[model samples]
Target chain A: MLADIEEFYRLDRLPHIWCPGCGNGIVLACLVKAIKELKYDQDKTVVVSGIGCSSRASAYLDFNTLHTTHGRALAFATGIKLAKPELNIFVITGDGDSSAIGGNHLIHAARRNIDLNVVIFNNNIYGMTGGQYSPLTPKVQKATTAPYGTIERPFDLAKLVEAAGATYVARSTAYHTRLTTELIINGAKNKGFSVTEVISQCPVSYGRRNRFNTPAAMLEWQREMAVPVIKARSMAPEELEGKIITGELYRGHAPEYVSEYTKLTQRLKEEAEGV
Target chain B: MPKDPANIGKPEVAIKDSWCKGCGICVALCPKKVLVMNAQGKAVVACPEKCVGCKMCAEHCPDYAITVEVE
Candidate 1:
């Protein structure tokens, strides 16, 4: 049984849709590793995703999956949670699909502290649809939509989730393979809502438009951007600029939606028995 | 570590010449440096020995002309 899980997660799915050196494959591997480590009831684990290159996850993973409309993954995932609270729901989306079109769903899901694991593949562009600007595309970065440079500020996903009331939040990149896997594993184990933002690379669209011409260069950028959170605390904001921060951004305990509702029902049962 | 280029499987990385569009994205991003743009501006696996099967070319190719298959 364990062997089945291991073999299923192999990188044999080529030719992959992402660029050859793109980090989405690495992030996908880490996610599968986390899922295997948890040994959650595979039948009960549902992978819900929206439209984008990252959203292609549903087609590859061997689990109950729902490939929903663009930026509506969270809405469908919410319905799944409300109907089958016992199941472990995971929402896989891209920076644009989730943060731009699906932003409200993301905030409300976190606000409820729902028992869902959200993995945002932040490649900084709308890759699957075509090279386009996304909400998380860094300021001044070149994209198909932004020929000269992007003017809008990017969203710091980890902080956004924490602010929205997600119980557990972490950040990692495709370059940090082991660390990313660990974060996903921990996020899956958390009882309440968990979010793991995986900063992946879009070598074809994002990299080519920008100065990063090679996959190695893209990988190097991921390495250079990452700043361990413990070290980030003491460093100046200037030091943190152009650097990716990877680690447990925030983790707190909250009454999980399903468990709390179950408790409420149990308490009502006890009161009725006394009557 | 020096990547063993010959150890990369497949006799020779071949791209359907007609399918190629002279997009140098593959030439720029290949970690193995196996591909190069010929005078026709078409991507060719000039140094198949350097390929690592990382799939960067096939992944980056906008036209889906590149294929990395195992022999």
Candidate 2:
């Protein structure tokens, strides 16, 4: 299909490297749609990805995309945001890439409140590296490393980022495509460290091990478990058991890092001129 | 001259077969069952007439193989 989005993608990279039913593709699509909706200059938009199946998106997208070291997408994106604050920066990362290997960077970036839009593709496992359990993998979910279900609790990434001081934080799943796209758009518009954790499906790895039989079944599970932010507020703790909250979880207005830095430098320059 | 008057302004469900991974996500999520997986494991437009133009299949294809345009 020669759709409008076709131009935003590297046509030669047709049929992305993602596996069949990989939710990474859906998230990627949502991201591109967000960019389109915002009318952001493709030339001025930068897409940064860390090492993983999700990181492979950089190669397929036609914009200025950087496929960086494992779990360092945020660092690279931070540098880009600081150096070229005029550009719209986006980080596409997996749960393992961001929360496990890049956990420190994720929190630090959020604390700084940089104008970086991050979409964590939380597929719950290290899919590209053979189904190893990740920091976001639910407790008791079986993985290659955890042959008999893990005892450790998974990180609530949205809450973690919100607590870490991100100006905008949201969560959505692949099943909620429209909402995912909308949240991504809002995340980009937040003008500070914005995190949109998308609960994606790793059918080949996380799904089969977890007995989700098929990718469609995994998507269906997301649909059943998801509750909008408004609905979640009324539900009691016990009633919200096993429910995934979707939608804009938090939005705080804070001075963006790059802009603040520019102001500081401008002030310093004026002082130097006065001297 | 358009051959089918009923087909006028119908939603266009375009499936790029080469890119389809035969995931059947579009078929499964389609509210109208307008798509089905072919014998070759690729998604195909089974009932173009039944399309409701929701674009659920297009949005969730994961493969980006389906593009539905509602005229």
Candidate 3:
């Protein structure tokens, strides 16, 4: 199926830093497959990431990559898009990198409807920092920081991005590889800010601390929790509790930021020249 | 590539042990149950004859450890 995995990666960086059975590889594979299917120009594509285990993806991919400061991937990506509107940009960020400290940037990016694809690798806990409870960590979940349990509720990533006015929003788990790849392709094709929240597994950091001690168990848990968006529609909210509603959650046409800026600058120049 | 006599006319499933984390996903997802984790915690072909070249294990493997070749 995906025969060209090596083509999308920097072979010198082989043997990624993620632990065995980590779902980050699966998400990366889906991303590579989506890029292949889209036949995007690698020279014109930029992969940006924030500080985290997931952010390490920028180093592995063979693209014009930018590994930015912690929780500032979208902000950096915004500058890149505004400077060079023709570039295809993809921001790979973790739950904590996006929703915790970068929450304001994420929401504002969606509000501005910038044409950039954002894929949030939501593994619940901050795996790179040794299992700190993140904004998307489910309530009552045990983390290194919250050994007893987390008291705060988690952010519904898809709903948050959708409410913030992203043109395309979708959710899928690492267990659903095909769906995740397809959703990423669709998100890249969308004209405005698109967020695809992939519920990934962090076996070493999150699983070891929680009851899911193995990668298989963590993946099985995701498999059991995921419900297709269409099927979830027929079920009541109470019945659908604790289920991951996967598939495209929202899609709307909007004015993309970079294009609007280009138009504004062109009109200003024309008025100045008295054309 | 010349076919090995041992696997001549048979589908070959190769597992890169170095990359495999012994997650058992390939074993669990294999429709024919042709794969299983060995004592060393690496996936091994349990029933190579039953393998239909479906590549489910290869597709689902998080480590990219499994590859299927069908003649």
Best by lDDT: 2
lDDT of 1 at A193: 85
Which of the two, 1 or 3, has more DockQ? 3
Docking quality (DockQ) for each candidate: 0.08, 0.71, 0.49
Please provide, for model 3 over B1-71, each residue's C-alpha lDDT reduced to its tens digit, 9 standing for 90 to 100: 77668878787888877778787778877889998889998889888888889877877777777788888
Q: Kindly report which residue stretches of model 2 are placed more than 4 angstroms away from their true locations once superposed.
A: B1-3
Interface RMSD of each: 9.3, 1.5, 2.5
TM-score of chain A of each: 0.91, 0.98, 0.97
lDDT (Cα, tens digit) per residue for candidate 1, span A199-253:
8888788999999867657766787889999999999998888788889999998
- What is the CA-based DockQ of model 3? 0.49
**In model 3, what is the error at residue B13, expressed in angstroms?**
1.9
Identify the CAPRI category of the predicted complex in candidate 1: incorrect
Clashing residue pairs in candidate 2 (N, C-alpha, C atoms within 3 angstroms)? none
Per-candidate total of colliding backbone pairs: 5, 0, 0
Which structure is stronger by TM-score: 2 or 3? 2
lDDT of 2 by residue, A1-275 (tens): 43868779998887788889999889888899999999999999999999998989999999999999999999999999888889999999999999999999999999999999999999999999999999988999999999999999888898898889899999999999889989999999888999999999999999999999888999999999999999999999898877899999999988888888999999999999999
Question: Local error of candidate 2 at A265, Å?
Answer: 1.6
